[model samples]
Target: MTANETIHPTAPATEIDASCKLPLLALLVGASIWLVIGSVLAMIAAIKFHAPDFLGACPLLTYGRVAAAANDALVYGFCLPASLAVIIWVFARLSQTVYALPLVPVVAAHIWHLGVFVGIASILLGNSTGFAWLEFPRGGSILILVAFVLIAIPTAATFGFRRDRTLYPSHWFLLAALLWFPWSYASANIFLVSMPVRGVAQGVIDLWFGNNLLFVWFSLVGLGVAFYFLPKLTGRPLYSYFYAQYVFWTLVLFGTWCGIPAGSPFPAWIPTLSNFAGYLLIVPVLGVLIITVKTLAGAPVTSSSDPTVAYFIAGLIAFIISGITLHLVAHNDQLARITEFTWFGQAQTQLQIFGFLAMILFGALYYILPRVLGFDFIFPKVTRAHFWFNLLGSVALVIPLAIAGYEQGSHAYNLDAALPALRVSSMGLLLILIGNLLFAGNVLAMFLSWKITLVKSIFSAVTSPLKAVEVKS
Candidate 1:
């Protein structure tokens, strides 16, 4: 057998881990790098939200471009890759099989980053297509599609090669995610950008794409991670595991139809149906909450100082809140009018993207990275700081923005409530920036620590042979 095949051959799980280590590291490191870039741009965008003239001098840093660039970087660069890394790792573990060609994911990771860079650069250079999430130009979008398909194909192949054919909930969710993204993304690009939809139809398609990619693609992976970790970390089997099927089905089926803008120019029934679907989403959202609480109820894992618990707990709660917000917002026209085109809507997106999805990824990384690196975390101290910084920062952004929305809406554009809201949100953006920096720093520190350890081992091996020969002489 080749040396590669023998890698931790005695343990099936270790072999899978060994096979995935390099790809996981590469994807995760790229994700962290993009996190810093996104956070910087996000801060800039948040500043411009109220100030508007903060970077007025620079065309490249215009509010539209900067905000769009930040959104793309966070969604495509950081969140997508980070989520993909977790999906890949969890899928492999569930399959109970080692990768036959690990290089597939490593190469795909590089190409994916390249595509994200291209998309962000295109947006900055005034080439944005002006679609919400499908802003990437044709070239960047195509690159992402191709790269994603490369990974998607392998994901399906891996399923066929699994040692365990009985699927877990995580497996089901991952499979759905693998299928959903490419379809939704390609359809959006085609209808919104490439072929071009006319009038309100374009808006409808864009909303459809954005909502699916979030509620379906991102949510699937995030919940898959949550479901896997909640049980695994607590050393308990998932309570009501059967209900997970209901959660997954409801999300994919109902969640897809729920995002039609409340005031969309479409037929009244369309919007009404969407509102009904939004209300139906309560089932799965509550299911996830119940499952998580029951799984971790009375478990000592919650009390641990690992920082992962903080992220997990925060992410799960935020998800519930975000979902509840969506459900009611759709049913209430008055509330929708208040929120539509307001910072309150943005706040909810942040809660879902940053507070729930990104936090889940953060927790997963805290657990996954150490295992992939084959070492316990060397600098565990700053992780707690990382959690607090991000948590507080996210709160600062969400709460004030929601208030700002209310102030602007309730007061008929009066600046009374907007004033304090802007100030506090700006401060929140700064905290978010700091948290991203700390996360990047920790990832780098861990990588460097691993490299140094590897180098010392190699040096000691070389010197030990020389010393033995000299002693023999």
Candidate 2:
């Protein structure tokens, strides 16, 4: 093939280095384990509402325990590792650097995974602070911080040692996310643990950290993956690089202070600042939408075959949907009537967790998995099953929760009987259980197939009889 044909001049996937695949593999394994465990706990937590009498007596298996474990696993277990995988890939690609020693990244991943194990265990033991998403025990938080620093070290080093002289729009998003995590985490730790902010300042710091978690950690990482995979999948250079650039810049600048899902009750300045910045998210949202549309406008046929593309596309839609919902939900008065520690809050989290982050991770895995395993997916049927189970299960689980939440919140707001409100919400909890079962089955099937294939290959190398028996079947 000519140099132009060989290099895949238009699409960006052609040049992806194979050596960068291992770190991604380790990360995905961690994510998959977490995803399965997290979703199951989420369902268990949801179900306990209806059958409060079911495991209510068990301290370790209590509703609070499961809820904390579920959210903690989802955040630290799935999202963090998965996003790091994307970061590894993007850093390698933009750096035009191959992994001279892949073991370093792998070691970093092991450290992160260890921290996740400790955090989940700590939370499940009822050592949490009862905070949403930041519920990991103090000891767990320290371990997680150490893990974060370890992972960030290689990323920062990659940036400094990069081959690509000019940074891409995606690079800005990645860097911003890396920076935001430490800032938000540190502030949250200080406020929630170290000094313990007093009165409204506590609420203010809580709002700041929560908003930062959503905008910077989840959205920034999601957007970064989108920025990379969308153009790469469409087989086009980024469309209107300037617009993409503007989107990245605006998001980092204005998306910082908008996390008052229950709205702020502080000084006028607090709410004003948060609300104003929340509205400003539109600048980046609209800008990126235009860029994505332009990039995918005339893509190659190969785009359809690429799971990465599909996943990236799904995440982009989720990001926009969540962004808009965030605005609608940020009204303190409106949320005051709706956010009564109910599933309504969990619904938005699901959108951010499963809808935005998980989808992107799926895309990242779709591309990274086959490359690392030295094979195409062992079974397309299993792959499709995994995707559908997660997609539908998330909707099935989240939608009913949202409905139940609204019912509970509306009733509570009007001073109705709490028991009746709880009873009504119980139905949604049942649906979540069914959804989790389906999702867990799908994940098990996918991993089992891979395991079988690997085992079969190993035996076949020793004797053709093993292969012949399989062929006969």
Candidate 3:
């Protein structure tokens, strides 16, 4: 085991065992493939809705099924596993113990991925119960839940058994995210799928789960990665433990109860509960933002050197934008009407996925792959291509959708109008299709490049002249 210095000036340095970084690469490849597939489905749904004649009347390609599949692939297939890759790395780094049982994580990853496959298949086949996010049939839901339990429990156990008693801010966020899933998943499933919670309770549970998934799962992963990389990039400890703690508790307390109070029949108190939480989130968002600003306040050189840090910073900005919009929508019913359906929601989702999640993962891959494969990015041009294609496509897809959503919602609230809003919305839908296609192309190129490079290395005589050697560092 090699000892590594703690970034914090006050904390003692710790040692990390020599562990094979296999699962990290494997999970990343798996997630990337899924993202490509998910993006294709997204484009298909966008096209089908915009042009009914494009796909004819194929039952398999129905708008609803495709849309559901898109969400399923993105959530279950890509985001969760990618985030888990980061989690595993964090656990290993924090623990500084050699990978005791790497195969366990591999097994966990396989079970979870399989569960996602079944869940998506069920949804596509119209076996869904039609609840947002919880649309997987009971049978599928059970499998997915079992997978979640299998993965999450061990992850938590690993964290609990770590020798490091002094927890980092990133650890706090990661642990919270891990704990949050089981609770959120169980609550939503129990209400929407099992016995059923009627009326407002159902809506409340749904909103609760949705918001928690974003904050606890997605947001935590983003923040944890940021926490790790930012320090590593700057070669300094975080500017303030005080600030991070404030943000952490504020996010935890507020994140759990956010996302309710829009025209639902649920008791006024439910949204009121969420509204208070939403408002409180502003403190953490601003506090964390300030901490970020202070920490990197003078480190532009470092930031430029690390695209992952840049992506993370951008994601935080996006998250703040989403957080503010969420707060406003939760409080004012009229504003919610306008912003709720508008491209605003679309913007939020895109910002979180692309600006935050995708960028962080890309940066992580860039940082990790070299070590794992003992080589630099095979083609820097391809990396740039991936970044720009996805970046521009994301902006193009999300902006129109947000604007279109606003137009549709405004028209709906004002006069008896469906056709006019639908017409405008169609334009936004078209943009989404174009953006998705571009993203798909970008991802496809990445995979092809990865595959070709590996093949060339295996048979160098027929491929490039560059020698291929196993990474031994």
Greater-lDDT candidate between 2 and 3: 2
lDDT of 3 by residue, 241-285 (tens): 788888888877787788775556776777677777876777877
Q: What local lDDT does model 3 show for residue 457?
A: 78
Greater-TM-score candidate between 1 and 2: 1
Instruction: Identify the runs in model 3 with alpha carbons over 4 angstroms from their true place.
Output: 1-20, 161-163, 302-304, 413-473
**Cand. 1 TM to true fold:** 0.92
Candidate 3, number of clashes: 4
TM-score of 3: 0.83
- lDDT for each residue of candidate 1 in 208-303, tens digit (9 for 90 to 100): 888887666778888888888777666667776688888888988888897886667987888888888998889888988888888778777644
lDDT of 2 by residue, 196-267 (tens): 867767777766777678656787788877777776666677777799778877877877877654334677
- Give the Cα lDDT of each candidate: 0.81, 0.69, 0.66
Where does the lowest 10-residue lDDT sum fall in candidate 1?
A: 1-10
